[model samples]
Target: MHARDSLDPSRSIWHFIAVHLRRYREAHGMSGQALGDVLDCDRSTVSRYESATLRLKRAHAEIIDRLWATNDMFTNLVDFADRADEGDWLLSLAEFERRATRIRMSDTSVIPGLLQTPDYARATLMAGTADDPNSALERRMSRKAAVFDKENPPRLTAFLGWAVLGQLVGTREVMRDQLAHLIELSELPQVSLRVVEKEAGAHPGLDGPFMILTVDDRDVAYTEAASRGRFLMDPFDIQEVAVRYDLISDIAAPVGPSRALLRAELEKYS
Candidate 1:
């Protein structure tokens, strides 16, 4: 790590964890690849975590604690870091997502990030970030667990614009795989997937994609643009977004038909 990078921990909570992670790993004379082997991940993943490009998951932190004999220190720090991370918009979204009991979203440009496959996410993230696309891709993929948690998964309803099916992201094969994954996810009882037809034309969703995350019976609205993201906290703002979601949802094809639509599109790619 560069000297300036090493000294940046005081500016961000994740940097503090990163600095210590590198310190303890090196103190034990362990290479990044060696540490990753113990963690059942790759060297790049370990490097991203140490650089704060990727958030350290709680389970990973616990394993590190045991490996380094840190006595739950890393565990406590992971918890704090999750709550304290405010430097990255997506990171904050991941934090709130894990706590949400319900999620409703509408996407016009592409598949929502939470529901994206690795290849799909990589393609989309690569178009956005010039610095480290792979790290951003991994960070986005890590957040999917919020929707897939078997013990207490959030109820997710996603409305995708019909154009999303036709848009070419990475490759024909990538979209084929992603559409297949969507079919499987739609089968889950807690997930409701729908598509707004191109014919639906100029709906409220044309403005942009937005998400409503429900936590403790309260809803928070999140909107993402090319350059930045906004988290709407005012009750009125959240309610308005919720209302728009309902308007869009009403026009979307229900899950059964949506799966058929996905399979139909899958054939084109195949």
Candidate 2:
């Protein structure tokens, strides 16, 4: 079956835009190549956009609006989507993480998922909502293998807030094991793990936790919140998150010192 045949418009704003845009084009008896001509791209790109595999940019929406005299509906849809939060971001996250060449992350609340140990992940999962925490734990644990065990794993640069070392997810043993695991991951050539000391004293890094992923030569970002995280696709949004990661990385301890810090914290738990 074709990708668009199974497309669900209600899945996300991106899907909504793609589904409707294709709808409008088909209703007017327009072909993908013709639409691609108006959008100044090749047919495959138009195909991806129409299948909701790629985001439909606001600029493209405006061009379509002008050509079809749709009263800026697509442009307006893009605007609404800009302000909206994408709660269903995990599928996209996994898809992009698999294709990523680089990943930069800054976490203020908990250990970043990719670096988290099983006990630590279990603790965090138990604290949150999960229909089956055990199943969730297994899935959570698989994320590390999924990303790192790939033939060419993405290079990872991670900044963990100092408080995270002492955050106390499960037990002293669990925390200690988690720190030890981090120390090990720090030794990997592909992973550069750092610690961001609290004394850095109030920068935009305090804004929250986020990760920027570089996939297929393009940048995308994910910003987490108390409830749900949002995927950022727009160039400006990606830039802002990149700046946040950079700011935090600047104050973050170097990898060697960060590993030393982890060891020091581990001694405390010992």
Candidate 3:
């Protein structure tokens, strides 16, 4: 499907702006950095705008319209910006987390967000990018505050791939700190940590990692790829994926065995 068709007009204005801007840039053969140069900002700034980290400005929207020679698109974006819900996406996610009585996640690569220490998050972000490592690290660190700062956080049940436990993300000291953090989080009364050992046979989640947030009225499943993240709200799809996740969890190690696995992996880094 085309990128433009993916946008929902009822969503935040930034979402609308980002979709169109990305489409225009791709059509014009303009790399984000090239566009950033035209806008007198850094490449990462362009990325943040696309990611809706930075708010879109009216002037910038006008510039983009002029550059792309779009007749009414610029005016529409400017009007949307004036009354756009500020940080609506993040607010929505935060509300989901807050209202959720339970959060179940299955992760194959990196540590789950609520369990990550700063050092571990830094290492993971750095490994994925060719840009400024510090900036990437900072962005990741900023995201963690939402999960860790709450006084009454949701119950968290996380199943990690054994590879994540075995992988050394940073220096030995950093790795040690990360494991310690995980161990501490696991001890929380509302948290459950499990590991799917490498020896565990094929399972439903072998395809990829995903998270399910169980709120008051419904559940939402989230999946992320290299360049995009999708939130699935359709009840049928969510129900199917939730069933698959449960089967995968059942086939993996139980909580007792998973904690043992984590302890052994921590020793390797120590």
**Which structure is stronger by TM-score: 2 or 3?**
2
- In candidate 1, where is summed lDDT lowest over 10 consecutive residues? 1-10
Candidate 2 overall Cα lDDT vs. reference?
Answer: 0.83
- Cα lDDT, model 3, residue 147: 55
lDDT of 2 by residue, 1-270 (tens): 565665567666777788898889999889999999889988877887886656888889899999889999999998987777565576556656766789999887799888998899999999998789998788766767779999999999998888888888989999989999999999999999999888887867678888888865567788888767777766788898988887787788999988999999999998
Alpha-carbon TM-score of each model against the true structure: 0.68, 0.78, 0.64
Q: What local lDDT score does residue 70 receive in model 2, on the 0 to 100 scale?
A: 96
Per-residue lDDT of candidate 3, residues 22-62 (tens digit): 77899999999999988888886676566443445667777
lDDT of 1 by residue, 1-270 (tens): 232263357655676788889899999999999999999998977876776545577899999999988999989998986565344566557766876789999998999988899999988888775478877777777788755864889999999999998999998999999999999899988999998987787899888989998854557788988766777755678889989998997788888888999999999987
- Runs with alpha carbons beyond 4 Å of true place in candidate 3: 1-95, 130-136
- Clashing pairs for model 2 are none
Whole-model Cα lDDT of every candidate shown, in order: 0.82, 0.83, 0.71
**Candidate 2 versus the native: TM-score?**
0.78
- Using TM-score as the measure, what is the rank order of every candidate, best first? 2, 1, 3
Clashes of each: 0, 0, 0
lDDT of 1 at 206: 89
Best by lDDT: 2
Best by TM-score: 2
